[model samples]
Target: MADPVAITAPTTVLIKVIHCIVGIMTAPLPHPTGLAYHRMGHCTGRHRWWRPLLGTLLFLGAYLVLSLVLFALSYGVGAAAGLRELPDGGHDFGPLANTALDLTSIAIALPLILLAVWWPGRRPPGTLSSVDGRLRWRWLARCLLAAVLPVAVLAVTAALLPDSGSDSGEFGAWVGWRSFLTSLAVLAVLVPVQAAAEEYVFRGWLTQAVGAFVRSPWFAVLPQAPLFAAAHGWGTTWGFLGLLVFGVVAGWLTIRTGGLEAAVALHVLNNLLGFGVAAAVVDGLSSDETAADSPWQLALADVATTLLYAALVLWLARRHQPRRLASPVASSPAPAPAPATTGRTVGHHGESGQDR
Candidate 1:
């Protein structure tokens, strides 16, 4: 797994470009290849010596290239159809995409995971090693601490805040129960894939790579936190914070527990529950008779929710003070003793002097 063999800069760039093109054209959604490549690029010192700076640059380039390609495709289709102007109403297409992205990620991610799992080695790194296989009780507690506390804090804050000028209003109604059920089924099927991708990136890949370089827990845990956060983009500050903090906690737990299973379990459960809550809230509050309006307000609420959620997650992590898992000590080698020296007797001027 350690690809220490030097990859020439030109080769890396060429591979990256090919990867971006293949990944984009093949998948309906952008492949997580960009993410995987970036992470590998950083770990391998291909990306500006441990900084993901070049990796980020590569990702952005890939993203831009992919976006342009998609735009061209759409434009071509639109032109052939004789459509001069785009639709005025939005077609957010969440339900439509639900199946493709989920299925694609799983279909792509699983084979790679299996390959990594089956590969023979002196020791499998991350939580995959036999010694680290045992699950810990405290991880479940941390999962609970992560999922519940943040939502509770956000709910309270939303309750207290005056319904200001905002736009939770334009939020559309849920798809039919059937559509929702289908989405749920797709999610259930894909949760493992999504969770595995995250765990592989954060706990499996980055944590081990970071652990190899840094002796201290902070150094190992700190770097991946922001990466996790930034991956969420400006989705919501609080949510971003929550995931980043959760990333740190999970990384620490993996370092301690020696397995990514617990982290994956917690992540899937958290996401499923969060999605369920949001769906339920949307359905329960909105009706044809009482439809609301406000875009800016919803945006504000999102920001607030992300911030509040992040704060709560960090607070919980602080309260728990989970340390890195205990690693077994290795046997020490004994020190070698100093070698003995014998001096040959020096000959004197005469035989009598030598005898005396």
Candidate 2:
């Protein structure tokens, strides 16, 4: 969904504050190690089989309630006011709308996830972000930068191919500068948040959920792949396979890097480009088509580009060696300050003496 996220000083400040919290949270763990990102829920060494199960339930119930409240507030109280949603008893969405609304719906999950972890899961909320118990913003930024190229490559490859999926031979008419720009504007804000939220839920929460029970990273990684694909709804066989591959690859990278940054980076860029392209053409955003709708050729292209992106990110990880485990190796204590030089010479008896 493409609900408009206002570009405001408050939002900017809020983001900065969040990054600041990461460092603060990561400051105290002593010898926090031998844990992968998937096992973060067990970071406190208090893993019950039912903790994540309960957190899941809490997240779902809260999500449903919050979604309703948000809809009511946005559509009922705001510009979409007075529009009746229910003919009989169902909720109305026509008043408030789609993409944006949908985006807003998913975006809220990111925060609620932390809450669920902190409360029901009985762990620090930051663990949901990484094994370090917080986001490593610098690492995330590097991944984000590394992510852009492959998505662009995918885009160019798609453009190079025939329009196998389009009904008409031509791409649709221009959406006009105003509409096009508006869509980009809104998408720019929403895509990153929505994509990151998915990573938190699937790669972060789901992986940790399973990892808490198992020792193998493969066990933690595989189950969420199908679920992630299923979340998009089955589109075509090839497309479904593509999404599955995407999920598996992304999950693996999340564990490999010890956080969700790589996954989130790729997802954010992929979605932003996809949405930007759709918004460029008439009725594009209105089209319900998603990554799940790709043809076999496009799906193949996606696989190639995605793999390439993963390789690139892994290479970057090697060079930078950002912590991919429970806690970064702590810095050694600063050497104690050198003793101040006394002007007097020390005696062989180890006493300070007057100049010899």
Q: Write the per-residue lDDT of candidate 2 for residues 48-119, one digit (tens) a residue.
A: 889989999999899999988877676555444554555433344431145787788889999998888877
> What lDDT tens digits, residue by residue, belong to model 1 across residues 158-247?
456665533344445555677567656766666656666667666664554565445565676778778876655555444465566567
lDDT score at residue 87, model 2, on the 0-100 scale? 40
- Give the worst 10-residue stretch by lDDT in candidate 2: 87-96
TM-score against native, each model: 0.47, 0.78
Q: Total clashing residue pairs per candidate?
A: 12, 6
> Which candidate has the highest lDDT of all?
2
RMSD of each: 16.2, 10.7
**Number of clashes found in candidate 2:** 6
Scored by lDDT, model 1 comes in at: 0.46
User: For model 2, what is the C-alpha lDDT against the true structure?
Assistant: 0.81
